[model samples]
Target: MGDYASQHSFRIAIVGGGISGLYCALAIHHHCTKAAVSFKVDVYEQAPEFKEIGAGIGLRPDAAQLIHNVGLGDGLTAIAGGSGDMLYRRFDDGGEIVTVPLSREGSVKLAPCARSELLELLKGGIESRGAATLHTGKACQRVEGLGDSVRIHFTDSTTADADLLIGSDGIHSQVRRQFVSDNATFSGFIAYRGVVPMKSLPQWPLPSYSVAWLAKHRHFLVFSISSNEALNIVAFVTKEESQVVHTKESWTSTCSRGEVFKDFEGFHPSVQDVIKLMPEEVSRWRINDHEPLDRWHYLDGKVVLLGDAAHAMTPHLGAGGSVGIADG
Candidate 1:
């Protein structure tokens, strides 16, 4: 996009179709001309649909700026609730921990929203610009790099050859597996997430601000995703190791109230209140992460990796999605 003009008329084929793929396509489309890019920016995903399968994400200042840079600034803010004035409390005794007000000026930028909602927003924005094409359900089984182009083989028996390929797939990316052979480092803790409707609230004590439960071996995080929706709660606990251990939480794992209560019985009553308000159908997953990589792009010709595929990180700081947004 700077001095050298693209070799083709299209933007070329893109490999993944989640938030990262969409953003990458838009960023490339923004900087390069229709002629500067290649033939088509085709995004390949393992899923049949583009909907978000997971929960919510926290948007930081850098993340918001990434959204705004891709021209989704207005819509992104419109869908998310204000978390700038969020208050925090330790449910151990329902005692207040600290109240950090973001509402003063730049606080809203640090808030979060449902992952599905934000992905939908990013998809709409990317398509609105008429820059890229997406191919879902066509998982990339393997990618072969040609000096001047690339060929991608899919599990669905279909194959496509293109100029550039971007692997925006998530942490379990097959594309990344071919490149990086290391395994995901386990974080000792697990997160239980669920959304409780306000109508179910006996007496809503959740601060206008997001709250966190810093219990002994367990902690819970509470915040609202939107004004009209239920509150999103995430409970974290140490995963007790067992000789016959098997994973109960995954990309899609649902749990029950009994299981949750068994984990957090030692916390405060108010914490109990929050847990009691939660539905029996809660979700859980062990926190896993990747080591930081020196570079994201593996430009053997026109192939590169983006987002978590390139550098998956821990979610303790709640920057998982933000990092993906930034990479795009």
Candidate 2:
């Protein structure tokens, strides 16, 4: 097997139409193309449409370098500001904290990319490469090991059989659900996140970086997500609002600015002023965490977990998205 003339030809079945799934297909495709080997890749997503949400991602130089290595530089650079900076402020007063110039530390290319923008760019690139198939609205119901091949059954009444089955479905992954009874964990606090147009902030310059505001009640985050996008804002507070949240499986939902402003009363009026500008509720989620499992691989001879499906976190370090992109 070590000295065979024919390289191993791969047929990959990726479950989940999220970034990790798409990225996996892309990676496999690029590798086979480089090796001049034949392979097929397909991704299954449960959504009717893959609409990128209001979340903003913070990427370190290492993460950006990884994207470049995958030959996604142009697409990454398109919706991402690789030359951005990082700014900080006090949560209460909105007073200026020390500003840190990111991306100046050697070959680091950092930027805040809107989750939607990143998805659009990544999906577009995947299609342009002609290396993978994305089947949106097709949810993976089951993955069964069938000797040398794996069988993938979907809710859409279709199935795919491939040499390798990948479960990159995400935190509440059905693949994970089938593999283990207890995996996901609750991290104990909920996050209220939203974005306001720059036009909403007349006192600020076109923000050239990301900012973190720390207060007693909760910590707030603001950053410029993309060139044409709004200024991103997120607040992580310890409230019993989890009981008030609408959905059970979902982590986030939309809320009015008044709801969020109530928590930051003693802080700065500038903060409340900013809140008043928001038109409506965006998204909120009660954060959670899980202990790393001994076995990420499962199902006799097939299936593997990726992204939050594998490792969920509280995201206190601003590296959650960075880590996810790095995992990709």
lDDT of 1 by residue, 1-328 (tens): 2122254454467777877787777777776654454445667777888888556677877787777877787787776755545566665676777777665464337647777888888788767877677667898898887656667899888888776677887777777777777777676777888777756766655556377767666778777675536567788888754511454436456667788898887776666777898767777777777888766666553767877787777676777677777887
Write the residue-wise lDDT of candidate 2 on 137-188 in tens digits.
8888877777767788888788888776788787788888877887665565
Off by over 4 Å in 2: 1-8, 81-84, 94-98, 205-209, 241-252
What is residue 85's positional error in candidate 2, in angstroms?
3.5
Per-model lDDT: 0.71, 0.70
Q: Against the true structure, what is each candidate's TM-score?
A: 0.88, 0.88
Clashes of each: 12, 9
Question: At residue 79, what lDDT does model 1 achieve?
Answer: 68
